[model samples]
Target: MPNGPTRYDTVLLGSPVWNVLRPPMIMSTFTEALDFRGKTVIPITTRAMSGLGTAERDYTASCPGATLAEGLAVRGEEVSKAEAEVQTWLKRIGLPPR
Candidate 1:
């Protein structure tokens, strides 16, 4: 794992929903690499048709002791038009667009 801060006040986890699951890499990163205790976790997922699936749930499980915020799911085809939506979500989570 890359060396960096082990603790954070906020964490943004983005993943592509695949087959009703988060990608394996994301799972590994959260479950095996990071420590999220007491942090605010925001799960964001993009899906073609599978929807958000269990991305949020899985992330919550992986980051035990963390505070999970409302998650955001964007349709893959709508990504290009989702800037406003993304900004809104960011704002909702207390991280206004910069």
Candidate 2:
């Protein structure tokens, strides 16, 4: 069996965009299998250029009633330098910096 589950108010879902628009098929499968209702769902993306792509729409559809928070999209090569940006995003979403 897996470890004990922890409760949370927010979720960060991440994926690398495929073909400059869509997230990988695995993302769709993963999201569809989860229950995100009433939570703050935020999408994180590692991209070459196309921003958050269709993550916002995809999550909105898959996670019914979830509060869609601002998503974070970082350059694929710049993930290591995204700490500050991520912190800011968390704050903006009413979460304390971790």
Candidate 3:
């Protein structure tokens, strides 16, 4: 939420999954600082072993009124090789690779 206008078309929310969930701090801080009424939220989570699990669900719940996109779950070990996958996901979401 950094001191700025409280509006955006899209938001990329990244975090590391802990115990099959997003850290509690993320949930509290983000929800408190930002309002997601009309934003498109794309959640990305990094995990060492567990997969996405409830990360997407948690993000959806956190951003109550936002449009939730298909979330991306990246394995910590594959992060180095995830460029293509990340690009694909970006394309699928109507965003060109940068």
- Backbone N/Cα/C clashes per model: 0, 0, 0
Against the true structure, candidate 1 has what lDDT? Answer: 0.74
Q: Which lDDT tens digits does candidate 3 get at residues 2-81?
A: 63226668888777788765545655467547677778878788887766657667767767787888878899889999
Candidate 1: worst-modelled 10 consecutive residues by lDDT: 1-10
Candidate 2 lowest-lDDT run of ten = 1-10
| C-alpha lDDT values of all predictions | 0.74, 0.84, 0.75
lDDT (Cα, tens digit) per residue for candidate 1, span 13-97: 7778877566556564655466677778787788877666787677777778878888888998899999999889888877869
Give the candidates in order of lDDT, highest first.
2, 3, 1
Query: Which has the greatest TM-score?
Result: 2
Q: How well does each candidate superpose onto the true structure, as a TM-score?
A: 0.80, 0.86, 0.82
Give Cα distance to truth, residue 60, candidate 2, Å.
0.5
Ordered list by TM-score, greatest first: 2, 3, 1
Model 3 ranges off by over 4 Å: 1-7
